[model samples]
Target chain A: MSTARANRMTPYLFLAPAGIVLAVALFYPICYMIYASFLDWNPSQRIGEADFIGLRNYTKLFSDAAFRESMWVTIKFSMVVVTIEMILGVGLALLLDRNIRGMSVLRTLFILPMMIAPIVVGLMWRYMYHPTVGIFNRTLTDWGFDPIPWLADGDWAFASVVIADVWQWTPFIFILSLAALQSLPASAIEASKIDGATGWQQIIYIKLPLMLPVLIVTLLLRLIDSFKVLEVILVMTNGGPGLSTEILSLRINRTASEFRELGEAAAMSNLLLIVLLILTFTMFIYNKAQDARMARLRKVEEEV
Target chain B: MSDKTYDRQNPAFYALLIALVVMAIGPIYLMLATSLKLNVDIMSDSSSLLFMPTLRNYETALCDFLWYEPEHLRRCDPTFGRALVNSLVIGLVSTAITLVIGTMAAYALVRFRFMGRDVVSLWTLMMRMVPPAVLLVPVFGIWTFQFGIDGSRGGIVLVYVALNLPFVIWILQSFIVQVPIQLEEAARMDGAGPFQVFFLVVLPLIKPGIAAASIFTFRVAWNEFLLANALADRNSRTVPVTIVNSLTEFDIDWGVIMATGMLLAIPPIIFTFVASRQIITGMTAGAVKG
Candidate 1:
């Protein structure tokens, strides 16, 4: 009886440290940020000392053109980056799904770009995009072509950042979808092949339908991560050429540090957090629905 | 499309594979090559590959840590060396703390059906998507004013531990689920207490999960800049923070900066090469599993 009683407390015991840390460091700070959003806070004033101007910071955000622009940039960046990465990544995964030699080596090499620090990634790209000494410009000059203003002009800066992100993240989608593809019920693919389905027909009809679930999850994950990308863009452009590449995260960082408006920054953060939370909640709901559907199908099959 | 085992592909396919590999590794190779070159060679409008490789850049970045003073060094900046130490300490300590607490929590969630278990799992799932950038403002405020631990390695470690716990717990849960419950029961039957059973039986089975969790936790801590930047004082700065700080100069030291970026990037790259399988397993744990 005593042993069982002691065992009853084990779960709490195991959970306490993580619970404490998350509460104090993660959960509390998030709450603090939400409260701070309503106040006219600054770097100098403590949270308690600041005047709580109920939702003024939030109201101010809507009128702020820069904030709107930056938010738009964030959305645009995520959509473009995810779409391009998905196309290239899934395409590469599909094309390279064969029983090839040195596949591990190929994967290991592909993981390099994703594995390296985003700061370093930005640096590599910045060097390559450098006008005088960068490899791209050098090659362009060698071929007697005009050098593009990679990070100088606004439009080009956005494209440059997108290219860097694609280089870094395409392999991630490739690897994930590759795992999904390889794990795909071989019997199903074999049946499709035996049914005289051509490559295109097999991919369009059978393989894609099966891969949709994993692809949606991958897309959502990538979309959420693209919002988190700041350091790479920071190192590359520093949101230069007049806020052209200033995504929401970078804007928040700038607002707090450069502008010294902590409350407004917190409000921006709260908005970004809400967007992410919605995405996460969607993913959670989707996963639950997927499981429930699978169970229902299994039950029906059992009855049959 | 047939499942002809290890079927030979056309030469163009192999060529495409080679091209992809080159494209993937190209920028990394350029960074490495730049880190090894002098500023003069880097700036020179000449053949890029003809320059003599040197460790001058690395020497400059790691000057304070070297046994002997580099003769070529004029003023040794202790910033990179100091930040390197801070990064390593923060990365390792945070990884250790996050892994221990995270694994225990994961084990409990997996083995025991307790109240609020669903809440905890959902919380973990949500927190995994919380970006460090999103945490920047409040973490800075609380650390500085409320917590009073700002500008210290401890503060940085605290945030990192908090940031990584959710994902670590989530990943380890999947791993711990695969552990045979019968083994734990046997251990318990041998008069082993719950703690003993967890430590002796369950812990050993989840080595791959631990490896994956540690790599990811350490990577975030080491590579993190925005929070670390806001929290760290001059002396407590990590490599990423220092590298970003160095980028604001009008005349940038391309060689040394590249070398510093390379240093900051080395651990994750090494982890990738060493444990690619575990890393992949960790990354695809959720989306692919779903």
Candidate 2:
């Protein structure tokens, strides 16, 4: 081959391994799951032996109350966690966006929660939320107050999982928001300040608007992630306090393992997959829009 | 007086910020404090902020047979030491593999104008968007069936690489694009082979990018739980898996779990502290600029 031809082929050569892996490991599994979702699959039955139900599983799931509850729990959980995390995260980023000694250390410390293994985080928070011995109740007792049921009560169990999730993942938003904040054009904010805009006013009118794109992407990313969350809640509550904390992933786990309804679980996963697909599609479209906008701006600059 | 005036002007803002920070980090602080307290102390004053602190929890966690059955002589509790080692091995090895393979792919994507380039890039991006849950059942089936690689560290490592490859490729590709191709062209003109040019010229040029990618991969693998739980049996259990298994509501040991959490958080926390600036800059350079 000519040198140019060889050079052009080099990328394809390098990309082969990853391509094969993705094709086999990713696409194949997804196809298998999709195929399996069509079957009356039980744990014992092989794919070949299983009767192909042809959307029966999906149809069954629509009327399943437990599955519906799980979906509701997932939606509620994602909404609550993402909303609170965004608020706290953006709020924290705004607060910490300043030059000071040890600020980097403080910022690193702030994001520490996101670094620990989710299972470890779940275990850690579980310990801290222990009814009789956890630090929350311990501290409350020290203050001469009655210890509230943290994990036993259904509502509290849901809130407990949300708290642990927010604790671990809010840092994701914090770092992204902080980066967005730092990247905002300084002069715009400086001009706003000079125009008698208060800090809050500047943040509202200038900073937030500038950071909106990053925030939206980050929000979508977090939402997508929160939808798939399983390990922490599994480790912490095991979807306990009578299914109060059972998010979709947990429900899928239990359905497959505990209920031994592999087909049902697969169907539920397909539902979750659809929800995520919508979110992912929205994000993809949003990203394309932003990229197109940037390309237009670049073209304008080139013309200038 | 000027300082006082400034303080007065920013009072509520500063207060709100401080309160938010405290709220954000409150549970972690509580975990740390609880990790240092004795079980008796922890249990006795479940609501008490004022406890005589002790290192007994850490001591018991690290030294004592908290989960030992005396008659059986089998340590039923998962050892934090073993889990740590497993995590480090899996994280480091997978990260190294990812770096090598991902960099090569990224370099190709950035430099080569070839057929299916857009499709390749799109494939890589879509890999990242594939949620772990979607793959778990299928992967579990595949690993258990095809390879008989059930619950092995190697199996988990392979899955981690698959999970992390797209991210590494995307990030490294951006960095590789920032590297000028003219240098490689010059190296080629000097009769350097592709391998020589890559290793001697381009590799050193993207060391920081590689470092950032490597560290990010390491963090992801280290913090990963789902695949580890799915793939690794007790013999190859990672820190996260061990910690999860430790949480037994019927006969819970809060202190040991807290101690394990503290231990699990240490590596990544230390990593963040050591490379905070590099991480911040590297992450933004790839993410924000794109």
Leading candidate by lDDT: 1
Cα error, residue B49 of model 2, in Å, equals 6.8
**Residue-wise C-alpha lDDT for candidate 2, range B1-290, written one tens digit per residue:** 12322223356766765775686667777788877766676667344577787666565545533443334224443366667778989999999888888888887777765645556555665667777777766677777776778788888888888888888887777777777888999999999877678889988988878877887889888988776877888778888877776665467667667877887778777877788766766556534564
Model 1 spans with C-alpha error above 4 angstroms: B1-5, B116-118
lDDT tens readout by residue for model 2, A38-122: 8887766656777988999888988888778888999999999999999988998887787544456566766667666677677
Q: After aligning candidate 1 to the native by TM-score, how far in Å is the CA of A280 from where it should be?
A: 0.7
lDDT of 1 by residue, B163-238 (tens): 9999999999999999999998888888999999999899988999999999999988888889999999988999
Q: Residue B263, candidate 2: how far off, in angstroms? A: 2.3
Checking candidate 1 for backbone clashes, the offending pairs are none
Model 1, span A1-304: residue lDDT tens: 9988989899999989999999999999899889989999899988889998998999999999999999999999999999999999999999999898788889999999988888899899998999889999999998999998999999999999999999999999999999999888999999988989999998889888999899999999999899999989999999987889999999999999999999999999999999999998888889889989989999999999
Query: What is the CA-based DockQ of model 2?
Result: 0.44
| Chain B TM-score, candidates in order | 0.96, 0.86
